[model samples]
Target: DVILKCDAYDGFTSNNSDENDNVGNPSLQYDIGINKCWKAVGPAHKQRYLEYTDEHISVKDDPIKTSVKGNNTSNAPKVEQTNNNHPSIVAGKQLSQIQTSLFQSLPFARYLNLITSLGQPLGHHSQTRRFRPGL
Candidate 1:
């Protein structure tokens, strides 16, 4: 089982009214992924895909081929709304407003820091101050 995760910015255009006719910050961001299965299959699991060498089994002779039925795909959870500004909660569990802050949450605002070279840690802005074009 494998879990894939990705993040992307969907909107940042000069045409956007909010951008003031310039490229503005992304209006939408998303993190999407597939969660792995909880069940574990050991090395001996017959249904697991295997690599063979020298005189490998043919497709008809492969074990566990017929046992698999229905969709093998896993259903990923819906994208949690960071705009909600709420800590994550266990499924089927509710939290009082006061207790919610105790849980750690995603820091979506950090994405804004990537917008400018000055905001980066690589010192691009600091180096520019020392530029000596005449030299």
Candidate 2:
């Protein structure tokens, strides 16, 4: 009985070895062969191609092709005219009574340290000191 050690087995070919063995080994070979499946598919793909954008045959570009844009403008939720403000929410139910201090949810404003804030834990926007670059 004989046992091949380490990489020796890889180098030693046996009767059971693959005929395409070298094709899979990067050190032995790389260019397996020109993919001829494209030959029959090329013309068919070109036929359905969009003018400049993607076409029906998206395989060469994307393994899975899809035509749907999940949340595109067409399917997006419509904007509701509630008490919407640029920097804060409304303290009251209507836009006419907009006030940040009482109604503001300032988490995002505080986290990003934007230029404004209305509530606690004080967030980042409340800082007025800018040019000091230190204080």
Candidate 3:
């Protein structure tokens, strides 16, 4: 529901009020979920977290090296050259979009951590992805 509400590009509003529900808070959900998987490996610790307090975020279309032609078996990699100056656009209810909206992280927030002082992981969200890799 939270992700759905945050459909506009770089637009999200938190309504943690007396009548609304803050339980769907994305940052809290993302962190505890990732940490659980991290601790499961014993050595794989989660060192990064989603920024929940941020109100707005700007996303840039940084070029990711993807094969211009799919299913390639060539020695040299061919990538599609594109103008990376454009704002990245996620259609609706996406993780990257939601994170940017809630946390106000820099475009493609690659270097961020959950700034909390909890002894252990908190609430968990069922869906997990490789948003954060290492501590």
* Best model per lDDT: 3
Expressed as tens digits, the lDDT of each residue in 1-135 for candidate 2 is 111221132233233344446443224211111111111112332322111111223323432221222322342212212122211111111221222443355554465445444333543332111011001
Off by over 4 Å in 1: 1-49, 67-135
Better of 2 and 3 by lDDT: 3
State each candidate's clash count.
0, 1, 2
Q: Provide the TM-score for each candidate, comma-separated.
A: 0.14, 0.12, 0.19
C-alpha lDDT values of all predictions: 0.23, 0.24, 0.29
- Candidate 3: RMSD to truth: 15.9
RMSD of 2: 25.1
Write the residue-wise lDDT of candidate 3 on 25-105 in tens digits. 344222222111111112224444322211222112111212333443543223322232212212122554554464454
- The alpha-carbon deviation from the true structure for residue 44 of candidate 1, after best TM-score superposition, in angstroms, is 9.1
Residue 112's lDDT in candidate 1: 39
* Model 1's TM-score against the true structure: 0.14
Per-residue alpha-carbon lDDT of candidate 1 for residues 1-83, written as tens digits (9 for 90 to 100): 00011111211223456467565554432111111111112243233211211232232343322122233233312222222
